[model samples]
Target: MTDSDTGHSPVWARSKRRRSSGGGGGAFFGFLVFLLALFGAVVIGMSIKERSVAGGGAAIDGWIATGKASVMQAIGKAPAAADVAVEKAGDAAAATGDAVQAEAAQTADALKKQ
Candidate 1:
């Protein structure tokens, strides 16, 4: 009897048949996402390891202090200019105080004389 009459297809005939389509692209994208997650975990773990080796919290503190110092230097006034400003403010305040006191004394004397 022939292979088709025996109810079994021949291997060559099966090989010649077209295969059904599958969700191959979805599976490939899922694998890529898994690899990316694995890579991210490894990178985070290595960063933690490096931070631990490089003084951990102290390193972070030092970085913060350095950043603060850099900002202060960038925004801070020069010492000489700051001193001059302070002196000018103090002199202006003193002069204002003296003028107010003199005005008050003159007002009091005028009231007493009247």
Candidate 2:
């Protein structure tokens, strides 16, 4: 293709001109990059400030309270098996004591016979 077909500037010639222009576009691009970086920093800082002011801290506290309430509610609704378990535990202890007493009585009888 001809140079005129390619926007009236030869590819190599445009490259030469760009190099001769002391990098103006490069400087402008660098300035744009700096501006964007500053804008991003400002946005992040504002976001942090907004969250601190707009109940983000309260939101976390509320979540913790809600979680605690749910746990308590779950515990409240658990099956009532404690009474039966305690009765069985008492019966087991009594049986264990009786077995020990019986063994002691047999030992005492043997000593008396001797």
Candidate 3:
């Protein structure tokens, strides 16, 4: 049989056109909505992950670090200085008391010898 009579189609033949007119606009809008939803979902997921990373445990760590630094600073400044001052005062008082006791004992011994 001849090529035209065999009803065989060419590989490059154009396909049939669809009859719908407004389907393109609807498809475009649906795709746009899908993209917006996907973007929103991604943003929400990232925020949730970020929050978890910074939530109770992480917040507690930060507070603990701040407290530790504050304690270190307090230790570095006034309280330790006060402690040193108090120790020096105590040493001076004890030394003064010992000197007074020694003088009193010497005076008593001299009186007894006289």
Q: CA lDDT of each candidate?
A: 0.78, 0.79, 0.77
Query: What is candidate 2's lDDT per residue for 1-114, written digit by digit as tens?
Result: 876786788679889987879758878888999999986675566558657534544554576899999999878766556767888999999999999999999999999999
* Ten contiguous residues with the weakest lDDT in model 3: 10-19
Every model's TM-score: 0.34, 0.37, 0.35
lDDT tens digits by residue: candidate 3, 1-114? 765688865544423223255658978998999999986675566557667634645555676899999998987899878989999999999999999999999999999999
Each model's Cα RMSD: 21.0, 21.0, 27.2
Going through the candidates in order, what is the number of backbone clashes in each?
0, 0, 0
Q: In angstroms, give how far residue 105 of model 3 lies from its true place.
A: 0.3
Colliding pairs, model 2: none
Clashing pairs for model 3 are none
Cα RMSD, model 2 = 21.0
Put the candidates in lDDT order, highest first: 2, 1, 3
At residue 99, candidate 3 shows an lDDT of 100
Q: Report how far residue 92 has shifted in candidate 2, in Å.
A: 3.1
